[model samples]
Target: MTRLHRRQALRLIAGATGATLATPAIIRAQTPSELKIGGMLPLSGPAAIEGHQVLKGLEFAVKEANAAGGALDREIVLMVEDDEANTTRGVIAVRKLIETDKVPFIVGTYASAVVIATMQITKEYGVPLLSGGSTSVAATDANEPGNPWFFRSWPSSVDQGLDTANAITGRFGAKTVAIIHDSGSYGYSLGDQVEQVVKDNGGEILSRDTYNAGEQDFTTLLTRIRSEKPDAVYIGGWAGDGAMIVRQATEVGLRTQFVGSGSMVSDDFIELAGPASEGFAVATLYEPSTPNVYGAEFGKRFEAEVGQAAGTLNSLGFDSTSIGIEAVRRTGGTDSKAVRDMIATGLADFPIVQGPEGATAAFDAKGSVDFPNFIAVIKDGVRTLA
Candidate 1:
């Protein structure tokens, strides 16, 4: 079934008392024995590279939490599933985690489309879900009321869109631009926001186009964009696809400046695009090169555990899991209702791990974190703060 249809069905099955029903006597009775946390991620699909990085960060966080004496004096157990970046698979993975594993709190699914689709299952089971990487604005839109079980650890695309637009026009002095996206929910929503920001900032959108995720060839789209001869091109997609577009744009002689959203900051993009990635600009949240106390500490811990420097996905994963653990501790137990209430009502003042930006993470009423946005450029195939 389609993602929308499945969400509708799940919502119907949940009915009005889904929240109360989800808190079974068995769950409350078993909370004292073990504190189980569930997670879902792409793991084996188009977004797997990003998903795996996020999972590693979560694993490291769980390890740290356990070493620090665990939450509420109970050992924490993390269970994960592979969503494969597919909505149907995401539904199944989340269901198994919520029902079969009986985890009260879950984290995961890097792709915004997967998060959007599987969130219904969390609502049905009354499990709180903390987004590890998804950045679509719709993920926490206040208009869609009733589900308070959702929260985001990263800044929304709205922040990235506004940052990119301002950087393109204010810094680069671009008057017109062409846009391309992945045609998935994340890319499309971010692209739409950037398009509006462009217009609002006294710039013209020369052309707009989209490509499906995992598509390699972009000659036709690049040729069409080249004809418009915009001052720059804005890309709203993941690293793999964005890298291909940059390489092909070079081969086709599309000479416009390329600016991208946060997803373009991955090492995958730099490795795939090689020399073509130079001079590419992106609006992102975390810049490892920027010296900060939190980044330094997190970098050391992450390198010790995963043997690599931390990136955006890794930082987000660590922060989200840390926040969830703090909420559980504050509530004094693993009751889903109590944890959810703490997150919604007292998350703003909760003392947790600082974000990569070296600021204490605070959540607005919408469950979105307020963090700084940064502009970076690819210099010698490496992303450096601009």
Candidate 2:
């Protein structure tokens, strides 16, 4: 329950900035005995399930790094806070980490809205943020001219939306589609992109609708969508909202092909939707079937640690943390500016853990990693790569 006041945070940032400018030699000369990375996740809200999985992935990575004599011979520690999927809470969490815990780098924030809100604070504090699950293009774009402190370890929502549109039109031969999304930042941004991609590919958008998060009753939205009678329905939300939509769509007798964002590939959605989840397609960046020794070993270790198979976001958390640790190791110190520069410049060609697409993790100029998005189908309550 630690909170950082605005004045206190600003004062800390001012002090850190002054120190960086006044004594560059002293900043470089000081080598920290241990490395502490901060994390802000929705560990107590509707997104808690996914958030906990992400936490496990981060913890597993830290455990592995510590087992191997730690990063730069300094033990790595993770300081986490529960964002609760709220913007205000997210900002407070980031502030507490930056000013209170004094971590040089942070990783986490599953929801795009949370990441967007927290990144501003990290930028002000001159700390690097390694995002694990926030896929909004705007998250990194907000950094503007030169995003030296923010890095996204996942594919952009724009790419995922385009991939979903291509799969629907190309594989399913759908000429018309309807779009439904939650009212959150991630859903709205991704839904808008998906709608445009569908239109660009010679597909007509029959209808577009939105619902609020934590809404259990989707009958009203489903009824309107049923009236349009599009060939397919695209869900631009997380697994929980996606599950309710699928189940309600079935109840309303709207038998259209259902496709979803990467968030729908989780076991929670599959189990919650039951038979309704069958034949559902999801565009995702992580494929557990990645053919690489590193991927296989990571998957095995993740399952052994969490007692369940790893999902896309789990792998994302692992990659984001691993890349951050590599940046810290390359810098040979815990200085935030040095780590940020190394990540921005040296991260592109450096080899880290393999992503779901079997590609080595690399960051672009905008701090986004390039990875292929694949469409997966849920068959008999299991997600299979399509």
Candidate 3:
């Protein structure tokens, strides 16, 4: 398809809006010579490390796809925007990608709220969004067939919450639980799911608290949790905050077992928490020890190119990009509706990096990946499947 040029698209948009163009678009519309895909990520602020990892993974996939003759007989171009994990920024970034860069599909936005906020813009533009990081069930609820533009690669918060809650009650024998989470959609929903599971399993809720995203000092909260004498503390937030909380909990002598989900499964948490990360159990999809054949090869290439071991975020990014490439290849073009249909109803048992012996990623009716969840424990500073 021949899309509008930058100047032409700007003129069309300006004419359509019946308003003066405030500023020129940062990136011009995709040229007819190359196929373009958009990515919105938290490349700054607290989630920079994760965003970089996802970017690296996407880069690797693009390079590989290009080497394999590219998708739709054109080089796959990935244009990214730094959402900074903020909703307004995410909306702006996605809008720029669609209206300015004219990307037919987008692939990211780590924070759940950012994904939720950007969905409307993608839908309005008739673009598809494939996310690897955002895991809130609310996002899944929004991606039904009635609005089939958003598809997620990662398991939902509900799945991870259930796994972590079961680990708390079954593995740790925790009768009383305390919860700490950020005020974001991901954290809040995770906390609710964990709390409900713990209650369903006949556990007591000692305390539930919410904190800002990058709050460094968890001393007061840890002290209160210690006094409450809970058997386990479930933390739902990013890796940096999770590390700080566990470290502070240990310092304040809160001896209960520490459990977490999503970002807690990251090495950044362990490296930051140091010895405090010992015995920390987290729900995760990726484990370095057990990768499928394709994943193992991808990990080796990823380590060589990125100069580090690949994590869950990287794997998720790769998987999401793989599906996008496949969709474009199967459809023979980057038409948004065609790609969305290829993913939602046409895809079947597409291989991915996380799962059983031969793990594959496929979307359910609600656009959630049909995959199993597992609990991994940080034993002796290594994340091993439990």
The best candidate in terms of lDDT: 3
Q: How many Å off is the CA of 249 in candidate 2? A: 1.5
Clashes per prediction? 0, 0, 0
Cα lDDT computed for each candidate against the true fold: 0.76, 0.77, 0.78
For candidate 3, the lDDT comes to: 0.78
Off by over 4 Å in 2: 1-34, 352-358
Writing each residue's lDDT as its tens digit, candidate 3 over 1-386 gives: 01112111100011134454343233334566688888889999877767877777788888888999988677889989999988778877887788777776788878888888888667656777888488888887886554567888656787778778878888889999999999887888889988988898889999899999899899988998899998889999888889999899889998978888777776777899999999898887776665467667777888887887777878778888888888888987767778878887666657777655565556666676645567888899988878
Q: Which residues of candidate 1, in runs, are more than 4 Å off?
A: 1-34, 142-147, 350-358
Once superposed on the true structure, which residue ranges of model 3 sit more than 4 Å away at CA? Answer: 1-33
Alpha-carbon TM-score of each model against the true structure: 0.88, 0.88, 0.89
- Write down the TM-score for model 2: 0.88
TM-score of 1: 0.88
Clashing pairs in 2: none
The worst-scoring run of ten residues by lDDT in candidate 1 lies at 3-12
